[model samples]
Target: MSWLVDKDWWMKTYRGLIVKSMKLSFEMDQQATDLLSKMLDGRGNVIEFDEMKNLFKEYNESIVFGCGPSLLPDLDFLLESGNLRNKLLISADGATSVLINHDIIPHIVVTDLDGLIADIAWASLKGSVIVIHAHGDNIERIERFVPMFKGRLIGSTQVEPRPHVYNFGGFTDGDRGVFLSRTLGILRITLAGFDLNGEPYSCPGKLVPFNKRIKKKKLEVAKTLLKELVSKGVGFFNVRGEPYVL
Candidate 1:
């Protein structure tokens, strides 16, 4: 249900989409991937795939937090409703800092090494299992930060699977975290702060520097990939905005 299934899923479902549609550079992704493997093999404390799977058993349910506008409000609702007990908190990229700032250190964090490095580092030192995603844009960061990260490191990539880096059937950091959860055998996943359509009127843009249209396109891709995952008999419940639509 893990290694074999994951490899098949990556090839069958995601690889073509990444290469043909998204037009991602396979060469660059592989370069970043090889760097990750080198770090894992030589200088890093890379968590073996099986050992990483065992860590997911600490909680069967996980709430994946994105940097959408509803993120904080949803966390507040979960706290007020008293339904957050025993939930494995997984922060996607920048959400790690938000969660830590709120005094709730997530049990795991997923990132591409683009967020505030110091915040991610703090969470790592405090025992969060950091799921590091390697891709074209962050090869430098992979070399710079990986050696300094303190806890268990789970390596991820989209190009291909390796002894250390893995393909878990997701594209963006947020959905990639969800895919990782499901691939590791966790069936229940919740989404928070995921504004698929666009940023709300009251909220600043998620990635303000990028063109809004491009950001919207990326969000739609994430939503589509997540829906595809759900269509395959996985359970994903949205905690904010409209329920998931296929």
Candidate 2:
């Protein structure tokens, strides 16, 4: 994904130490990447880079929905705005549930195969292209779910780019969606359901078992990277009344 930002720039922007802090290893990340590549061999379901560009070619804007406290309110605001007509809907991992409950299947869903297997699978079945992120923690999950998606998915990673896994310049799913939009040449990106500075990242309480402190740090890393993008002139917007200022 050297379209919007080059791989070298991404390498210089984010650090592998951050990924390592999450207990994700380079070997494991590569394992996941190679697994996805092997599974995709001779398959016709590839979600190619050109396909991504085409997916946003006619759209005037794209919206990334995060699994934050303000997600519902932001969704309501977006729905009330009456602007769902030409916007590409991208949802972060757990945010897929929110969109699905609203009867709105996102155009693309970014996930690490952490939780909500049923929801992610359901979304894929409903014509939503899934962008699966791989790392040390999700190799098993990737093995379990990649075959099931049958080509309706794209692979991503934070460590490095392999034949299958493309390193988009974001750590978390939400910001990664933003990176995807920017890389695909989407002009305007509105972020909903992002609570960047809200209440200390308590949302992932019981769903996924990970250290909260480390997770909070990852969120901060995401925020910093996003601010950098904003400073660099990427069109990013936060929903009204949300804690996030981007």
Task: Give the clashing pairs for model 1.
Answer: none
Q: Which candidate is the best by lDDT?
A: 1
For TM-score, the strongest prediction is 2
What lDDT score is found at residue 189 in candidate 1?
A: 82
Tens digit per residue, CA lDDT, model 1, 103-130: 8888888888877778888999898888
**Model 1, TM vs. native:** 0.88
Flag regions of model 1 displaced more than 4 Å.
Answer: 1-9, 12-15, 200-209, 240-243
Q: Candidate 2's residue-wise lDDT over 91-132, tens digit each? A: 998888878888999999998877577787899989888888
Clashing pairs in 2: 45-151
